[model samples]
Target: MIKDKYTYINREISWLQFNARVLQEAEDESVPLIERLRFLGIFSNNLDEFFKVRYATIKRIEEAGKAARSELGGYAASELLEIITQIVIKQQSESLDILNKIHEKLEDENIYIVKEDQIDESQHSFIKNYFIQHVSPALVTIVLSDQVDLPTLKDSAAYLACNMKLLDGKCQYALIEISRTMDRFVVLPKKDNIDYIIMLDDLLRYCLHDIFSIFEYQDITAHMIKITRDGELDFDSDLSKSFIEKISDSVKHRQIGEPIRFVYDKTIDEETLRYFMDKMSIETNDSVIPGGRYHNRRDYMDFPSLGRTDLLYDKISPLPVKGLSLERSIFSTIANKDYLVYTPFHTFSYIVKFLREAALDPKVKSIKITIYRLAQISHVASSLINAAKNGKKVTVAIELQARFDEQANIDYAEQMVSEGINLLFGVRGLKVHSKMCVIEREEEDSIVRYGFISTGNFNESTAKVYTDFTLLTADQRILKDINKVFNFFETNYKIFRYKHIITSPHYTKSRFFKMIDNEIENVKKGKPAFIKIKLNSISSYMMIDKLYEASRAGVKIQMIIRGLCCLVPGVRGMSENIEIISIIDKFLEHTRMLIFCNNDDPKVFISSADWMTRNIENRVEVTCPIYDNDIKQELMDIFEICWNDNVKARILDETQSNIYKKNDLPKVHSQFDTYDYYLKKLQS
Candidate 1:
């Protein structure tokens, strides 16, 4: 049973495996060509954040001489860091290969990504004029010397390391910060009905002669270099400063955070690389990654369509839930039966409609909501503000520390605070990650509570690509628990007990464990017993151990996990009853659901929390039970739809091989099939 002395794969490594699935999409020629390029971009973006957050954390632990194995799952922190570096280097190399193949394929479609040398005479004038008109003034170039101190390189932006060799046996180094304000992929004037585009990096390379006209140099070479810094924001314990002020300062200071990883082109000159490491005090043990000619591939996410509809996935108009009406009162509909709004398949306007109705309704006494992340132009914030202006008591618990969205939330936080709305900055030592809203409406007989809980944020932007579930219910039992969670936010010193919804930082772990224990007990009693779960990630060792115990008790477990799963299933006698599969498809699988068999009576829940320890014990999260039988059946149906997906599902076993869960049975692409499912549901 001792397989390599460890039952689970490292979470970081499992995370990389998950990313590799994204990369696999890029490699699959069956996918649209332009979509493949964007997949490469997503892969790059995910890697950048991984290094910034996860890798940076392990580096700090290693630096403090506390590189313990237990803290990092199994390997010591130093060893884990080395392993991560090696894996990233390999993945970077593979990404370059996939990119080159995609470029070749793009040419077959009459779309070309030409390099600096590859541009023809017809495109020369347009390129030069475009550069002089657009690129010259925006450029920031710094000449390097021993006397002059190097400017702190931005972690998010990419830079070109310029090496110049002068006539009199001397060499000089310079840095050119790539302007993120400009587009990375520049579409040149179309010629002969053929689309031609050049990257911003190559455009600058083409204009290097013009850029260095002032300085006399024999030769100059530019190569891409990028650095990622620790993304964790440390707040000051200043009693005088408000929570917003502390968070604002922390976000500002994140720009100059310590470097966690340094990436340079493999062909970069040793002299320039050495000069950079020496000047920046980059140690040998630091993540020194070498990659291809270009970095910051994330900009590819916005790759120009070039009007080629044939080269992209066909856009699907979001389907409307049958019973939920957008034009009428959302509360009136929810008061009867609970409705589930599945995004990318179902329209997100229902959530907006619910809030807007609450905002305008004269009977609505008050609204309380918890916000984690919102879009740039958020309808959610505007609705909440409108409610405040309408004289309704609106209390907002906006988490100011929502990672990269901190500043955006802070801006809205200040605006909401100024707009006569009651704002709770955050709970001390707890980041409120729950997505919940409860509104009190004064009916003729009594005050009624109508609320919603979601497995995703209320942001309208992310709803397009991210698949999440938002449950709209008028069940007072559940809304009572939601209101308690909100009340506990204000009075955090006092603990609140909930009967319907399982909350984190106090009850999620114990309550969920009890669910698992029930299944285990039922299995021992020869009753029907099984568990099904859907999650973005699950790395909780305690949760894993409990599931293993259930598996040993012959309680069947099936998981549709989209991201980082450290649990190794399919091991004989240990996890034989547990089977896990991950689906990486056209849309991000972001739904979190859990189901347990209670003597053939199924109990199901939709949650805002994953099984990750942070979501369970460190943050404020919520899991609401499905009391409405119709909604419960819907959850079961969708989970089975996702589970039965053979086209995108990858088996999550001890090997971490990510093999497709394929058989002779008909192939089921869940994303498309899900939309069809909703379509049939609407018809039925």
Candidate 2:
């Protein structure tokens, strides 16, 4: 085990490395073309959030002092900040190269991403009319020289930094916020079987002269720029206002949060950049990222499908569970045995079907659920409302502080309350992060509870792209404890105990450490000992140290983490037994699974928590055991497949270089293989 003073990599830097793997997907020639483009969008979107949250927090620490570095674990905040900036700059350059290659490939298929100068006469007229009819009303232009306070710039909105040269040989600047209310891509009329699409920015650039014609400007130039602000919200402990009002005020505060980044076109004049920065009070070190002609590459996530089905991968229909049907009562089937639903591979509708049945069943008495993130148009909320309308007591614990999702959750809470459902606005200080639902129904003489515990959110829209596992069971002990969690949410003063479930802010961290200790003891006894964990991240120093102890005790460790793994694997004598690989492919690996070799009688758990500090000590999370024989074997099989993947898996090492695992054996893409594995099970 090679142990040094620096025992772990910084979490923020590790996260950036994970995103580089996503960029690799865009560069891989074997990937489907359109899928590659979408990966680029995913990479860009991930970076945006990293800046808004993680980077912003680190910058704050840097400004505080060197004393804050001790609290950050090992690396100084200033040092980490410099590393992140350098790494992001390199990744951005790589992304530009990948984009150029993708464009060349697109031209081979007769598809073109054109700018304003490339548009023909017919396309020009089409874009002009389209802009006037659809985009004009939403456009708001601020004349920069005359504004009292530079209009509060939005977090992710793109803007055009207009520089107008008047007939008097004087220069002035104006700002136009891109109309996100309208589509960002405008498809033009195809000519000679070639398809052309223009960006929203370019379309505006084409009509710049027309927009400022009233001002008698001789020369007009518009360059794209975007500002990313710190999204953290500060709430006052007034005691007079309700939680709802506090959250609303926080949302308003988010709009005016300090600017953390100012990205603009490099081609813009120095005077223009300085003008905007001065008004926003932005310092030089505050991420003044200069880029291409367009900003907000995240808009590419909605790039038009173009109706060229051949250019994209065929959409796979979510398969039905082998024995469960939508028409049947889900509770009765779950009562027979535990069943697992693997989403996108297995239909997410099974969850909805279970709730719907409970709503209309005459014997059902009450329903309790905890929602952290929800779909925009949620069927889950609708089912709860229907149950409430049917006279069943329904209670919902909604986390109104879910980042970027506060507004939607507040809306759902209000609507659910109006429908006579009992609504709880989470715990006072901790955000409830568990994805669980319980329904109580009377059977003969006793009330029986049936529910689902999941490793992901209840949002159906994300279920299609995020690979997760939901276990539907009628286990008495687990459901009884789930009820306790819901009770804790409703009555914050009350404390609850659990024998089977591991819950955060109380027992989760201690429980996991105990499990790791057991593995260490088993290894000391000269018995078979191994640990396997699959999660989104692993950054908590305490947990990392525990894993290191187990590694030194001769316990073999295998990890399949999809994002932000701070522990350096494969270090001699220190972590030589630990092998870590991350897979970034068609679907996000979001399921949190942990397996321990309990002297050959293995133990497995599916959890909503990762091994991060926030999940263990700051948030409310749940981790449940897999007891059913069939389900345990299924999870083991999935984990093994992911661990063996060489195609998309990247090694996590000390240098933080994201290198794909290479072998001479036949290539195995775990996602495609997992799909095939499930399909075969259905056939059997």
Per-model CA lDDT versus the true structure: 0.91, 0.87
Instruction: List TM-scores for all candidates, in order.
Output: 0.98, 0.98
Each prediction's RMSD over C-alphas, in Å, is 1.4, 1.6
Off by over 4 Å in 1: 1-5
The most accurate candidate by TM-score is: 1
User: Candidate 2, after superposition: displacement of residue 189 in Å?
Assistant: 1.0
Query: Candidate 2 residues 1-684, lDDT tens each?
Result: 222236777788788889999999899998878788888889999999999899889888877774655445466777777778888878887888898899899999898999988888778789889888877777888887745678899888889999888889988888988978888888888999998988888888888876776788787888888888898988989899989889989988887887887888889899878888888888897787877777787777777878888867678888888888788888878999999999978999999998899899999999999998888889988998999999999999889999999988888988998999998877877988999999898999999999999999998899999999999999999999999999888776877899999999899878988999999999999989999999999988788888988898889999998999878787887788898989998889999999999999999999999999889988889999999989999999999888889888888888778888989978788988888888999999
